[model samples]
Target: MTATASRHRLTTAKAMVDGIAAEMERDESVIVLGEDVGAYGGIFSSSTGLLDRFGATRVIDTPISETAFIGLGIGAAVEGLRPIVELMFVDFFGVCMDQIYNHMAKISYESGGNVKVPMVLTTAVGGGYSDGAQHSQCLWGTFAHLPGMKVVVPSNPYDAKGLMISAIRDDSPVVYMFHKGVLGLPWMAKNPRSVDEVPDEPFTVPIGKARVARAGSDVTVVTVSLSVHHALDVADRLATEGVDVEVLDLRSLVPLDREAILTSVAKTGRLVVVDEDYLSYGLSGEVVATVTDVDPGLLRAKVARVAVPDVPIPYAHALEYAVLPRPERIEAAIRAVVGA
Candidate 1:
């Protein structure tokens, strides 16, 4: 909450916690509750040091029943309390479907905009380090498809912190999904973009805006979460070989930035969507539809989609890498689209 010239940097997980801590300090109504979030911090270290600062009452940890805890958060929100509830892993969303999709999300609409559900449902998403099908899944489209909740997926620490603050301040319910790889966890595979300088003061990144991480004119690669880093890496690598690949990070999903995708696709005239989510009926397809539905003539050549096939994520490293939309696959898609 204080301003200083000294730059403070943090991993995506820590930066997220920092934003929550700042909001808690600013408003007494804001509180956090999730499994292992208090004494143990978060499984991904998203709530590190919160317990020491806020203590158990405000940063309480609940039992493993996600449905009960999430329902409790909804009740708190209805009573004018801003609650940040963690769902641990996105794959576990199945257990709390009625609470999430029916209640937490639709309360505002069902109440004719009179009731505000100011709650943040945060969860870890994406797959890469052999977490398998159950634990590893980027269900971006799953939450985005449902109306009522604003879905945001941050690819870096700065966005992570800013988005957390914004989600907390938002009057409606929000689904905040962070990728394990981008959390900068010690055990997960290293991601250079995961850690970055976040401001000491509180700030908010507009919920629906898309950031053009890499500017290019030859090809456009639109993605969200960890895939943004991969697209940027692919953009950098292909730049050396005369392939200009633009990378668009869809920081927020519920309000999909279709105009940004259209602008990039129109400028590049060749599109490649790299998504960690499934290849069908997800973010990738939605992006393609945005361009094609507007004007297919904008494309100079046929596009390529680099995304996980319709299959469960395998536990083995080799098999997992085979399905993940890695930098190599992104580079290949861009190269082929550019006819390089």
Candidate 2:
């Protein structure tokens, strides 16, 4: 069935689970392993209903041991099984860094291309819910920094499902980062775009491709995940004021879509990178570098960045909002770049 024919809308989290379930039905080798993924259906509901749909063998829950379960997923991938491992929170990667960076991300290269670690490390990211420093973080930069792993972050339900299918099908390890604020949870504050229409059938959104969420000529706002929503909100508000702003969502990070970023900047001649990740050594820097590397002359205005400062995320609600790249902060950055 075509996506248009599917009149119903789906949340980003539900779309993710639907995509994984479709893959499991086609391939019995695909399994899910993570804490609460079975019964609880993932802390953020990324795997909701998977356990009952696929049974315990396929959607197996494990003890609160990130290292053991993550390492097990790596080994299983080497043995020709596609394992979808959930890390719960992106900030919890400290507990199993070796298993991810060293093993799941490098086994194929270390094995002289003889071994393929076809696994998906899905996790939740962002800090709008006051999840605190330990539970709130967007560390896609760390995984994208390392080689042999593909990073995919979806801003909407359609991309979420398509990217999940692609990640499950890819031969290399894929890190799927979803922002908690985009999951469409009733308890949390979220954008209306979070519960948009999604295709009923499984599809693939190619890795490394950036999507133009909104088109404009005055300025380009390059971002991903939850920040995409924020940028779009700002763009819409600015459009009414006659300040045209483009919102570019870098759905996949590891492949790093240089062409899309360059194409957008080439048109606008002004850039503003908004990211939930830290200000230094992350997507914002990399995006600015991508432009300068091609041609500094293409840039008409100095690049502006709106990102979290180089500090641990605070636990207080006010502090968290103060640091995150909200719509007001994004609008300000766009104005600075556009001289509006």
Candidate 3:
């Protein structure tokens, strides 16, 4: 099949917003709604110029009521519109949990397949930007626990664009999480042959399909979001010491690529899960449980999890850094797994 080929230099945030705008233009049913999404063009400039392009009817700016706007988005989806609602920051999802978890997610199942809520909820997640506890949070784990929602966390510009497009077109409620830290990095924009080969035309990376970003056999490192980059960095460092580690980026968390996790564990015989969420009942715990339950003999060493402590995020930069997982922590975990 022939593929669309185009190249552009843009930040991860810009690419994602641009992809959303493109999809909106292609589909008349698609609309954007959130505080400052129209006139202000979003708090992070992710939606700049959208209001001017799509006009106020499509690019709506709502009051500072997340619960109300999210519910409106859900109701709109139930009708015919494919609304893309921005929650500003994922931490603020608490105010709209009823709409997201109970209403939109359960509507189809609760109605015995009579209704389908095809909407995308985009939010900023992760720490390191000094946004304090309310703004800087990696709450993908919260939505992952929900039954019907698909959770996606893109690690780079390419994945960000493709995954956002996929989320927009998906027939179920999808939470598209963009990490605040990697939005403008030059490395994320690098045209690595692997990702540069991504189709220029709009396409979807199937949800729940994990990508082995870097392959090796000594140990398997499963992570997502900012942790994916950290794991890759640690893998590179370990390679210099003759320790081979395979890095799996679990781009979508809810429909987790369980087969990929099991296969990688079987090959490496050791596993380490790095997540930005807290240690208790988080992504790390879920991954370890899944691997151990599938094949106890596949693990040569006890599975290790590098995660944040089970505590509220501190406001101090030093304390925040100490709480979140880092490359050093991932490197240590890899070394421990490989007996290096």
Candidate 4:
């Protein structure tokens, strides 16, 4: 009952439908196909009350046919079944990118590993409510630059019920990605930090680990889902303008925690990456080539990113927050990488 008071009763889409109803009540092979996840639980309510407790044959409710229920959830996770598939829109993944990037992410390295998909696909990405450009994109770097999945991206509801119970007890394929403005959606636009406290029981947030959510030495914003609440509201408005921002939070982009982005840019030598996807080859140029692939002299200036520029997300909520990365473009890329 403690873990932050069981997150005040859940809402990053009800802690991702209580981590897919605690892995479908401790795995009766964890099924849950998409579109309105049974009895209308997930048009982003993310499986609310999971079809009155997993009835209707493990909460089945498919038909919008994203490539035939994501190719029957990758042949029910390659015949073993731990599926949680729900791609209800990370801009529809181009009507099923061949059942998510070629067979729920390359079916266990093309079967040399004797197939074990173990799936968790869930979706619903970003855009501040205009939901235009084919329902607003946050492609999570086109499913974390393809290759057998584990993309995650929970930025609240205690890492969305511990990364949806560690992406339903991962065996391989994951790609979770939440952020329809952090899923507090009572018709969007009131994200009190994606509703807090989470942890009623079944826990686990470890999947590449990057959580320095707000500690600072000067400027490091990095970021993930919902731009990690727009870099923690521009690290609490640039810490009252003195600007000691450091907000990492890369909660798994196909295991891109790269030593916590080089230990938060070696303790904030300044690096602002805040991405709601788009703005060049994604995830803010792979977190600035993961800190210049090791050490662009650990940044001193010129690293700011604040994404969404590659255009096409407009339905006019003032041109979709004029290409979101919002908290005023992550406070002008964390005060222009701390040159303030």
Candidate 5:
């Protein structure tokens, strides 16, 4: 079974869950496991109706033991099942880091290529709905730092569906993050009722490839997850002021699509990375370093990063917005980079 060629209208979150469900329907080896994944459809309904359609055997619910369940997913993957484990929230990943980074990620390599763990661990990250520090932090950097794992953060529904498919099919473990903030945004939803032909097939967008969402000749704005939409918003607002900024969505972080980053940087000669994670030792920093390391002379100005402040996410709404990178801040960074 494959993705239907037919385009459908679905909320970003709904589309992602549906995409995973579709994959499960297509492949017998596919199974979903997590607390409430079977009955409650996951904490966010990202796995809603999966158990009803696939039955309890495929969409199994587990106890609230992250380490045990995550390890179980890894073991199941090694034994041939494609397990899609829901971590509920990114903050909970710490409890199972050993299973993920130490075991799942290294099993294939440690076995001299004899074993492969094709698992997908989906989790939610970021702030906006006031979920607080623990539930709202973006921890992509931690997983991206691990060499044997593929880190994916989809900014919209289209990318979410495509990337999730890729993650499920990947031989190694993949950490797929669905940002909580952008899930309900209408602009990213698929048009399910459209009369256009939607193919009844399953397809995947290759990992490590970045999409140039909005092309421009001015400074390049590189970002991923919720930042992509924010950057695009800022780009639109900046356009009125004659700042034609190009927006590149760094869809997959682990593969680190360096070519896309380099090309965009080479074109604009000015780069601003807007990331939700902390500025220091985050994806933003890595991108800036990549550009300068590749060709320092190509830059017209110092690379800038608009990111969450180096502090824990605050519980207060105003304080939360203050720390998380906003469109205005991104615009400022872009302008600073381009000297506009």
Candidate 6:
């Protein structure tokens, strides 16, 4: 596998494919198994050119049996193989979640550390382009709530590449959640951050760490995935009005970088959690608890949250936008938190 050009701009999909290809080249045991991953190059093009580069054997295209293919990946991982399995849509986890939660997640612990499941379950999430309730959902919270798997969501090309590399190497089950809105797909709405300069070398962004997308002292907004872009846009808009907003992009969820969350909240004294997942029993609530758990005295103003309400994502554009935590809703939440 050749290195990407230095500082060359790559879309999120390209970066992801490059990272997987690089790892597969370095480790023959690293194989990909999923629907349409071969000739189709993935529905969102995440596996574009992988078949040509690594051939059908390594990039195996399984039948439309999520349960069978996912179970096969888990067995392969236990036998000392690193498999990157694509689930197509995060919303479709119900089809094979038993394998994911019961076996893939707990096998290492159940085996008393004798076995390891070094597998990457890459899936697309979010609902902006009216894909309907069944086809679209940012179910990261559900995965994070589970005990054993690592949940990672990258907002940009750089982090996408780095996190994918890290997930491939990690000796545990990993849920790599990619929002279709950030995939830089020609058919979907585009965010500027989706396509950016990615380093040429095979680099790994430490999982369980958060990146401050924009530093500020006025208010802190903690978010992940596509919501990170919305927060950044709000941050920039607020900056011009003399209201500086700090944007924290949580690249991974299972590890839950509490220290980073506390550090930013302590500095700004105001916290606003923006999550694409549902509001109740999700990332938003966990973030609020993380801040208030240590000392409620740290908050200078009331904490606010921008998240999808406890409702299925609507298929209509207006209804879907209303449920999603878009930039307008995020900006309002920020203003409320900062009293700006």
Cα-lDDT of candidate 3: 0.84
Q: Model 3: what TM-score?
A: 0.93
Candidate 1 lDDT by residue in tens digits, 1-340: 4455555878899889989998999999999999999989999898999999999999999999999999999999999999999999999999998999999999999999999999999999988878889999998788999999999999999999899999999999999999999999988887788888988888899899999998999989898888898888778877888888888999999788899999999898999988898889888888888999999999999989998999999999999999999888888888888999
- Give me the runs in candidate 5 sitting further than 4 Å from their true place: 1-5, 185-200
lDDT of each: 0.91, 0.92, 0.84, 0.82, 0.84, 0.93
State residue 272's C-alpha deviation in candidate 3, in Å: 0.7
Q: Decide which is better by TM-score, 1 or 3.
A: 1
Native-referenced Cα lDDT, model 2 = 0.92
TM-score of each: 0.97, 0.98, 0.93, 0.36, 0.93, 0.98
Q: Tell me the spans in candidate 6 whose CA falls farther than 4 Å from its real position.
A: 1-5
Off by over 4 Å in 1: 1-4
lDDT of 4 by residue, 1-340 (tens): 4435333556687887887788789889998888888887878788887888778898888888888887887888788888888888888788678878888788788888898888888888887887689888887888888888889888888888888888889889898888777878888785688887776778889998889988889878888877777678767867886778878888898888789889889887888887877889887888889889889998888887878888788997888898887888788767766767
How many steric clashes does model 4 contain?
Answer: 2
- In terms of lDDT, the best-performing candidate is 6
Q: What's the C-alpha lDDT at position 170 in model 1?
A: 95
Q: How does residue 261 of candidate 3 score in lDDT?
A: 95
Show model 2 residue runs off by greater than 4 Å.
Answer: 1-4
- Which of 5 and 6 is ahead in lDDT? 6
Worst 10 residues of 4 by lDDT: 1-10
**Candidate 2 residues 1-340, lDDT tens each?**
4435653599988988889998999999999999899889898998999988889999999988999999999999999999999999988899999999999988989999999999999999989877788888898898899998999999999899999999999999999999999989877888999998887777899998999999999998999999999898888899999999998999999899999999999999999999999999988999999999989998999999999999888889889889999888988888888888
Tens-digit lDDT string for candidate 3 (278-303): 88988998998888788789999988
By lDDT rank, best first, the candidates go 6, 2, 1, 3, 5, 4
Across residues 1-340, which tens digit of lDDT does each residue of candidate 6 receive? Answer: 6554567889999999989988988999999999999999999998999999999999999999999999999999988899999999999999999999999999988989899999999999999999999988998999999899999999999999999999999998999999999989988899988999898789999999999899999989999999999899889889999999999999999899999999999999999999999999999999999999998888999989899999999999999999999999999988887777
